[model samples]
Every structure is written in structure tokens, then in C-alpha cells.
Target: MKRLILVVYLLITLGCDKKYLEAKPDRNLLVPVHLEDFQAILDNTADMNNSTYLNFVGADDYLTTNSGYQSASYLMQNAYLWKADIYQNSQTGDPVGDWSSCYKQVFNANVVLDGIDKLGGTADAKLAGVKGTALFFRAMAYFNLAQLFCKAYTTQGAANDAGIPIRLTADVNPRPARGTLTDTYRQIISDLESSLVIIAGNSNFKSRPSKLAVRALLARVYLAMGNYEQALFYAEAVLAESNSLLDYNTINATLARPFPAALPNGNAEVLFYSAMPSLAFLTSQQNSIHPEIYNAYSENDLRKQVFFIDRGNGIINFKGHYTGNVLLFAGLAIDEIYLTKSECLERLGRGAEAIACLNQLLIKRMKTGTYVAQVSTGSNLQLILTERRKELLYRNLRWMDLKRLNLEEATALVLTRTVNGVSYKLVPNSGLWVLPIPDNELIAGAVEQNIR
Candidate 1:
């Protein structure tokens, strides 16, 4: 029997009421009957895993080469230039795969959670772990979708702003309208909180969800939500579990690819392992690191040597991805947790503790004994944020950071891109920050598109 591929939207009868949408997985053929079967669905990295290629292109991390720019797909080119219409038309199909892929994960996760209760002889340990994992995956998918599809979560207008559709069941009922931003976050946080208690035990595999990974993800989500205290709490909780940083001094940075790729554990710093598809790897031959970002790295910083490959002629490619593959690491790592904790601490007025955290991470990133502890002062928030940007470059984060930072009166960022002698600028709080929902989805689901 063929596998049942669950989907977010269902095609309804024409002229039928829009509220009564319905879709069903293949009922007789591929329903998961056992623990292992559900686990297999969760383990399908190709479908269940998330990718950040479109977000990476939209972000300000790397610039495409002239040939790379011309050779890219229509969606890639448009996203690279931040055009209002990335999908072109309904006939063009989905502009990016992340949207569908993430929702598929959520569907599969719901399937697993629903089926687990029906299975007989499922041990207590198996039940707890599997249920916790399903919840974690669902929360993660929702969080990723919210970041891309919805506007930034502002305390003021979040109750009114449209969020991605929230699906908690595997049933055929599919009248899934976009909920308010506040409702979306409430669901995400609720899932994470529930999963945190269930996955309290540790897992040996970084790819698997565990208590620590939940904490890391919560830290990331809260940070995005601009809740500094909660972000710091979760970040430090993850740090408390394991706060190891890779010592760049120990690695041979001159190798063709400096980082080890095939390690079973992936990069030691990674708290949870998730990555963008390898197809989007930014090679020096293809994409160049923005000059300003690259120049900000001091000579003493080992990341300049280990994390980047100098392609002579002013072109540089990022090499320091935790996955050690072209797949940009879109997962949680200790370095990010430390940075998050540091930033939250600084923002919350624990400046000295924040500097200490930065110093700890920088000591490992910099050349042996060349690191200097930075001061914990008001002016240094920008410095801290700059370091955060540098540390997490090409990890599919800058777009959301730009959104939250733009909300601040002090750090409102106006971004500009110059392509082929034409200049494109994105003003702070521009609606372009929220990308359009793919046309086919908007039509099929009877949903409204984001305002340009």
C-alpha cells in the first residue's frame, strides 16, 4: 500500500461554504499501527525536516554571484531581490518548499500522536518519548511557519494580525483559517511546555528531541517574541545541561573544507540537529559573503579562518556550518544559546553577566589567548547584537532578527540591496517583511494573501 501523505489544505467543492473544508489521509492502506511505524514517519528527514533556503536567500547574509543570480530559479531570483511577487502567478506553483514541508511535518506529527493512543502494547517509555517528540515536531513546524507566513509578533497588534493556520488534529475537518498572531504563539508555547515535561529524559542523538532541545527551542522562540527574561531562562537552562563550545585553535582551518562533515554527533556545539537541504549550500564559487559582514570579523577571530573560505578576488563562502555540509545549520547550538542568554541578560540589565557570557564563547572562537573581555555598557548592545549576527550568519536567522530589531526605535534597520546597477531598499516595518502566501494555497484554502 502506498503511504498516506497528509496535507494542510483540502480542495473543497466549488460554491460550497468555505468553513467546511476537509481532507483525509489514505484510510485503509498506510495508517501507522505500531510505535516503530510512527517513528519512521518522524524520521523521514526528506519530508519531516525543515529547510531555510528561501529564508536564507531573503535574508541579508550572503549575496549571489552574477552568474548565480542569473541562473537561479524564478523564486530564488525574486526572493534574492525581495520582490513583492515571488511566486509570479498561480501557474508558477509553490515559490518555496518550506511552507508545505513544515506543514507536512505537523500533519505527520498529529498523525503520530493520534495513532499512539490506539496502539496496544506500547510501553510507557515508548509512549512518553513518542508523544513528546510528536508535540515537539508540531511546535517546531508551527514556529517556523509563523516566522515566515505571519507578521512579526508585536504586543500591540498581535491579536489582530493574521497568523498561520493552527492544526492540532489529524481529522478531516479543515476549515483552517489563519488565527491571530497571539493565538499562534499561544499554541506553540503550549506545545513546547507540554513536550518539555514529557521529554525530560535525555536522548543520545542530537537529531532527536529531548528536554534540553526543548529548552533551546523555547529560548529561540521567546527571543523572537521579544521576551528577554523567558528567553534567558530557557537559554541558561540549556547551557546548564551542556555548554561546550568548539575550540577553533584545535582545528586545521587551511583544509579545503575545514569542518568535519560526517560525524555521527555533528558539531559538538549543536544542541539539536536540523539543517536546510544541502542543495542550497553557498559555495564561494557561487555566493559571496557580504563585504561588511565579512570585514567585521577581526583578524584574531578564528571564525574568519575556519568558518569562511577566501575565494580570492573579494569573494568568500561560509564553511563553518555545524552540519559540516552545504546544508546551512538551521538547528539549535550551544553558541546560539550562549548568545541568546548574553543578549537577554544585557537587555534585562545584567550587563556584567552578559559580557561574561560573550567572553566565554568568544574565548573559544578566537585565537588562543587573543580574546579580550568586552565591557558591559549601554553602548555595547549594538556590539553584542553585531557579534550575534556574525556568530549566527547563514543560519537562516537574520530575516526574523531584522523584523524584531526593526520594532525597536533605537535599532530600526533599513535594509538595501544593489543588484545589476539597481538599488532596492526595504524600509523598517515594510509589509514586504511578511512574504506573500503562495497563490495556489491562498486559492485552494480560500485564505487571504499578505498585503504588499
Candidate 2:
């Protein structure tokens, strides 16, 4: 079934010029029809689990020298500078680009969902699991796309804000128009809430969606949306089931890849497994940690050694990825849940509880004996935010954090980059935070492009 799905995917996608919305599947080709076949479509991890890195490239966690900036592809160089236009009229067919990749995941999820409906019977555990998995994938893809392509969700302006096109079916002929930010997020939350009722508990294979994975994703989505109460609800739900954090002291920081391979990810911290698609600029040795971010970690913080490799002359390359390799892990993990929980607690005026919760994870991350429990004070919010930045670097959360935090005056940030003696800055709430739609999609004339 997997091979069959792959064949159909290749036949439809290879050398295709039509937008994802308009490209019709061949009627003559064998299509997935059975329950297992639909499951196979969801099981194709390469398509289902990999996501875009444009946000990562545009984020402030890393920096590169002028020569290194020149070495990057034109698209990435623009991203690094937070240019008004990053694509520069590039076509959409590139599978790793933000628009194409996320839409592809949405399409596949819709395929499985549409097929499941065609089965037309009372669903057994297997059938229900497949349905839940499809819903989770769709919601996850939508949440990720929203973070990059739409304005940050706020209670006030969401109704007026433009959002990515929301496609709910497998049919390709109908070009859906961009929906309201409220509608888009409502759909995401709806799908996740529905999946929560049907999916089983945590699966041994992290690649597959489980009950806890759904909760973890819900926690993350709510956090991004600034619904701190609901976010705390979901975060605590996940921690109730599984809240294991890897002790960095036990990991060998000297190895090229310190963590275990993600194929059989031994890292107990991971909840839902997904990775950012690889790009040359992100993996290049010339890329170094931003000084502000690098200096935040105290010398006794084991992450300083476990997460980075000093390449000499103060240039540091990140080696600590939960995916256990060069590919940045964008999936949910327990550590992130802790951060989310702590942040919510603090925002809700439970400062002492937030500090206690944060310390549970921080103790494991620091050297066993050198760790000091953080005290709850006026600085508790800033303290948790700092630790959040330090712990989740390169996991694809920083960009979203920047967007959400900037919604408030106190947490707003001004990001800057210097390339060839030229300085570029992206202010809080800049229109550039919302990326432009791919030119190919714009040329198709189905949806409106972002104003930036």
C-alpha cells in the first residue's frame, strides 16, 4: 500500500506545473481505496512529518559571516535579512518550500479522510485510529502554516486578518479562497479537538500521532494563539501522562551526534516526531550561534556543551538536535510542554507554581550538582522566557515565539542581522512577519497574497 501510494504521488507530482489546488490526480492510476490504504497515505513519514525551514532561516537564533551569507542560496539570503520578498517570484513546485510542503501535507490528510468516509461502516479501533491520525496531521499542518503565512492570532484583529486557504477535501478543482484568521484557527482547533476524542494513548513509535501527541500539539497551538488558560489545560493534560526530560549530564557531549538516531529515537523527551526539511544554508559550518543566545547559557549549563560545538574564534555550530542529527527537530516534546505550562502558570499569576514546574526541567538540563532552583519573583516571567529560548533553540519554535511574544509590549523583540557591513532590522509586528505567498500560487489567482 505504501509503494502504491508512493507511485501515485510521484505520477501526480513529478514535472507538474499546475498549482497544488488545480493539479488533478489521474483517473487511470491505481488509487488508495481500502482502510489500510488510507493508513498508508498517512504513514508516509517523508511527506507527512517533514516541514518548512523558512521561519528557521528568518529567525534570530543563528548568524553567519558575510562570506557565509554569500554562500547561501538567494532565497535563504533574503530570508536571513527578513526582506519584504523572500521568494523573489520563485515558483511553488519546490517540495521543501513553505507553501508547497504544508499544502501537500494538507492534501494527503484530506485524501485519507475522504477515503475513510467512503468506507461507510461502523469504525473499529483501527479505522478510528486512521481517522484520528489524518485529522491530527491536517491540524498540525494548518497550525504550522498559520504561524508562517498569517498574522499572529489575537482576540481583536483575527476577524479582519487574512489567513491561508483552508482546503478540507481531496478534490482539486475547487480553489478555496483565503479564510479569516479566526476561521483558520477555529478549523485547526476543531480538528485537534475531534482527534483528541478518537486517537489512542501514546504510541511507542513517536512518528505516529497519539492521544498525548494531540494534547501536546494543542498545548503548543493554544500557546501560540495566546490562550494561556486553555494552553495550560492542554499542557497539564500531556504532563499528566508523560513528562520525562532527558538528563543532559548522561549524554556524551563530545560525539558528533550526541543524542540517539531518530530512526529509533531513544530520546524519551520527544512526543510527536517531525523534522524540518534540510537546506544547505542551515547545515553549513559557517552558520554560528547568535552571541546573545550563546551567552545566555551559564558555563555550568550542560546544554552549552551538549547543544553546540565551538569551531574556534568564538564561532559555534549547533549540534544539539532532538532529531539526533543535523535535521532540526520541529516536533513536540515534553521539555517544550514544560515551558508552555510554566509560561501559562506565570501569565495566570501562579508564579510560585511556574517556578517549581520550570525547575523540574531545568534541573535535568544543568549539571547535576551545579543546578540552582529558580526563585519566584517579579522576574519570573523573564526568567522562564529566557530558559525557553535557551532550551528550544533550532526546534522551529523560536519564530512562533517571536511572533506571539511581540503581540505584547513587554515581550516584543527587535531582530537584527548584518550582512557585508549592511545592517537589517525587523521590528515587532512588522508586516514582513507574514511571508508572501508563492508566486505560482498567486499566478493561479485562487487566493489573495499577503500584503508584505
Which of the numbered candidates is closest to the native, going by highest lDDT? 2
lDDT of 2 by residue, 208-322 (tens): 9899999999999999889999999999999998887888899999998898866555778888889998778888888999999999999999999999999997789999998
lDDT of 1 by residue, 1-452 (tens): 13423321221121122334433335454456767777777766665555556777788887776778877777778888889988786444433477767767777788788888777423577877888888899999998888788888888988999998788876535648887999999999999998887764776676777898899999999999999999999998988879888889998898766666523575678777788875633443678888889999999998899888877877788887777766778887888999999899989988888888999988898888788878777656887899999999978888889889989989887777777778888888888888888776776675778998
Weakest ten-residue segment in model 2 by summed lDDT? 14-23
What are the TM-scores, per candidate, against the unseen true structure?
Answer: 0.92, 0.95
Give per-residue lDDT, candidate 2, residue 337. 95
Candidate 1 — what's its lDDT?
A: 0.78
Local distance difference test scores for all models:
0.78, 0.86
lDDT of 2 at 164: 80
Lowest lDDT 10-residue stretch of candidate 1? 7-16
